[model samples]
Target: MFYPLRERISTWTTSQQTAEEETELIQRKRIQDLPLLRAAKENDIHLLKQLLEDKNCDPFQRGAVGETALHVAVQHENLEAAEILLDEAPQLINQPMTSDLYQGEHILTFAACVGDIEIVKILLDHGANLHAKDSWGNTILHILVLQPSKSLLCQMLDFLLSKDGGKTLIDIPNARGLTPLKMAASEGNVTMFQHLIQKKRKIQWTYGPAATMMYDISECDSMEDHKSVLELIATSSKSQAHKILNVPPVKELLQKKWQNVGRPYTWFLTAVYILYMICVSLCCAHRPLKPREDNVTNQRDITIYVQKTLKEAYLSGDDRLRLVGEIISVVGAFILLLSELSQAYIFGLKYFISHNFWRDPFNIIRICYSCMILVILGMRLTDADGEVVPMSAALVLGWCYIMYFARGFQMLGPFTIIIRKMAASDLLKFCWLMAVVVCGYSLALYVTFQTVDPQALGAFYSYTMTLISTYCLFSNLLNGPANYTIDNPAMYSPLYSSFCVIAFLLMFNLLIAMMGDTQSAMAKKKEELWKAEISGATVKMEQTFPKSHWFCSESSGNDFKETRYISLEEKKWHPFHLEEASGSSSDDESDEDVPPQNSQERNPNLDPYQEIREDITDRAEDRGNVDHNDNEIWEEELFEF
Candidate 1:
């Protein structure tokens, strides 16, 4: 097989880096022979205890693998050996690996990754650091996501969260800047993503007026996983995405950011779009007059076609208004076209297509309007006069697309969303049904009556004419089907009546019912749905023009400060800080900076961790959930261990 030059160079570079790292790890590690570590690796419980009994033996010493005996025991799943090693040297429980493969990873992380709850519990009980991170800054929860068994992973997460200070571990970012929740989202693990998000019960008031949540929007600034969470959920299921967006913390965060950053940009775009619309209207209204075909032209002939060039229109003082309008319209259309292309560039072509950008009614209208303006200018330049249809279309689309801009306003935003929802869903489905019915009925009626009464059908006895007649007859069904009376009592007459009954009475009623249901369902979540729209809008702005580009980048109210003050009631969430909240005499100025504790402080009643654990437990209740008997055996052995 052949490889590209770039691929070869990349592979060589990665290999070289790996080799250098391994060489460095080997140099730093003490690769001396150690019988205690060896005994643990071989699960020799008797030898491990005998070696630990020796006064000179260092049970805490790392062997060639740069891991203490506890790490080796955990790695090899030597439960008895691990317990003996821990008993010999409790400090070995938190000893980090210096080897290249597991560099910076502690013994407890190794035990967690080993998928043995007993070993994990034993290590944690021995005072292993819960906040330990590997070389990639991955916490125990982060490493657990890599395990194949989601059920076991969820179970482990629940167990860990039940421990002290585990909530803090949920949002801790890795070296690549991905939290466990974000990593799950990036990997397209819907269940894990949902579980991670719903389990986050942390909420605190920042030093400033702003509030903070476990899921920080600021952390999503990295280009690699900027939109990974939202994009994954949206692509997987729109309803799920909406639900996530509507979550109280997520919605509040988005709302605050929009007020600080997104509102200004959105207002600017609204102004520009408004200008484009005005320009379009002016160009359509003040068209350049055509030349007089006859010596004495009537009033109607003067506005027939815009046949004059810009220079000619300018020279003819009477038509100079049209020239100015065209110039402005052309500029506006070019600007709008660039904006449209920018969306494609920002989202990338694959995402833009997969998300069905073109299917959006607003995008379709805006695109058609912009393209039509350019087309009209091209036609004018090429002397293709009397082009009424394109100009009329541009006018209609330009004004109608105001609904897209209307999304920025609170009052009109939900109404526009409801309209868009119906148009995209019910209207589209209705149109497809109408096309099928019209085409099918038109063909059936055309074939049925053509051979029997060719002349009665008329001289234009074609499918196109038949389709038109059938469409017109659909309207006449309200008037009691008067055309059926004129027709002879025949088979075709009954067929026409049946077509009217099915297409008009049945399909039309179904469309009405669908629209009503959609409206009613959406009405319940109107405010939430509106917030979701605003959140989506802000997210787009955030991705396109990041905070780094903001001129007023002052970090006060705009910035979400890391230091947040938790109330006494909510102090259980920060189990480590309960003593601090207890008014201990500490000289920390940051703690003094916290506002006076509020008596009305409230704690979250819902325990998402417990709920998710129950859900996972119920799903994995039966052995039949596993595909293979081997899986059951593996799970059972691991759990029992």
Candidate 2:
């Protein structure tokens, strides 16, 4: 034991010496990088200038952490020192860090990450490359995107927009294949996405064909990111989402993708749900018939009736079909439930429930019908014959769930959206108001009638009469109170009539106004609402597909770039065809539906020199007219750095 302890002590001694050696090496490097860099890091402006001018010290020399004097000044947030260093050695502005931790990071990257507008401007004025990349291939824009401060982010974005070629920087993806827009979307950074869109909106005209010189769509790298971007676009209320969705290229791509992938998946889901509905109907309709009391006169008659009922309920062909249908419905419900659970897991529980799930009338109906089916199944399993009420309600909800299929059609989609909105908002509020009125009036009538005939008046009779009469008032039957039986019709009739007229006029007019407002609001945004619905459906259907089918890989050849290339001008509608439609032209058709995996590609017909010259010209134009209308609309809780 003593010998082993001695050996361990010797090993510790050797390791300690190694650590000391490394420390000494770093200390020596700091010393060697001293004076100029040290002055900058310490914010000694006078010393920095003295060393730069008097001793002619090289400000470009890097320190232990691979930082030059300018880099050190930026990291320390010493603006004066940074300006001095840049003035002495302009080449130092774009010199990247040579150390492993910050290799390829220039002074501009530091300024961007530091959230200093002055330093950024100074560096750019000193001829710093705005497009320089860090070790991870993140540009200045990417670095700026990772900054935590929104005000600084806005300032930087504004400054960049004022610069030439700033808009084009947004479309450039880093090594990870994430453009600034896609990056913001992937991280759920709504404000960044909105600001970026505001800048893009000035240049990107949505109604026109996709002008490559101005804007281009970014593709998702993986299925997970694809799902995330789709989620952001679908649930966000920003007009930017609408703008991006309505881009002609995006619309065409979605249409092609829906036709190829979403259509078949939707059809399969529809068939399964339809089958489930049929089975539900069969199970409810084929329940055992109740025996008539008039026929059950004696023991022999009762016994005969019991045998016949048993034969019809359990042994007949319809009863067999009912059993099979129950099993099939259970399986279908289980499959749909699993689908929902997987979506919840993918998008998180809060999003799955709150965003669009509970608001959807179809989902609500499906849930109600499913719960009723489960209750019916449980009661049937116990050999109980009291599933009538649940079965009836379930049958009704099952039929109402057909509205889910309406979302696929453009005409039906907007209408369903309007109905859903009205029901949730206007109708729900109306019901609440009506509940208040009905409760108050019922209490008053109850008090009035109870005094007239305490023994004759049931506890709920006033409530029943009040509710029925109110409904009749809505239906325009003014004399509905006359049909009700009461201890004293005169006393009850006056109060009932007064309640009906007042409640009907107040509630119905308010409801009509509210519904009209809802209809008008939805009508104003009908196109946007319909597109959002279509995009949502497409995304949901996409999630059902396997990962192997996703287009995550890069394209091998230099095909046409961007999502799709339409003509520069919009095609005018005419009665006759202007050009011959070619069914066999694979090259022309390929450019329409097929999106390039690579974001950048060259047009073969355009001269490279001319294209570059035109691009330079376009970049030089002023971009001061950015739309800032969405600033107040977007939420301020942006992504963390």
lDDT of each: 0.67, 0.64
- The candidate 1 region of ten consecutive residues with least summed lDDT is 563-572
Those runs of model 1 whose alpha carbons end farther than 4 Å from true positions after fitting are: 1-117, 123-139, 143-177, 181-252, 289-315, 356-359, 447-461, 472-492, 542-641
lDDT of 2 by residue, 470-489 (tens): 55555566444332464464
Record all residue pairs in model 1 with backbone atoms less than 3 Å apart, i.e. clashing: none
Candidate 2 off by > 4 Å: 1-119, 124-179, 183-225, 228-231, 293-312, 452-479, 483-494, 547-641
Please estimate how well model 2 matches the true structure, expressed as its whole-model Cα lDDT. Answer: 0.64
Choose the strongest candidate by TM-score. Answer: 2
Whose lDDT is greatest here?
1
Residue-by-residue lDDT tens digits, candidate 1, 138-172: 88888887666777677777778767453477778
Q: Cα-based RMSD of the predictions, in order?
A: 16.9, 17.9
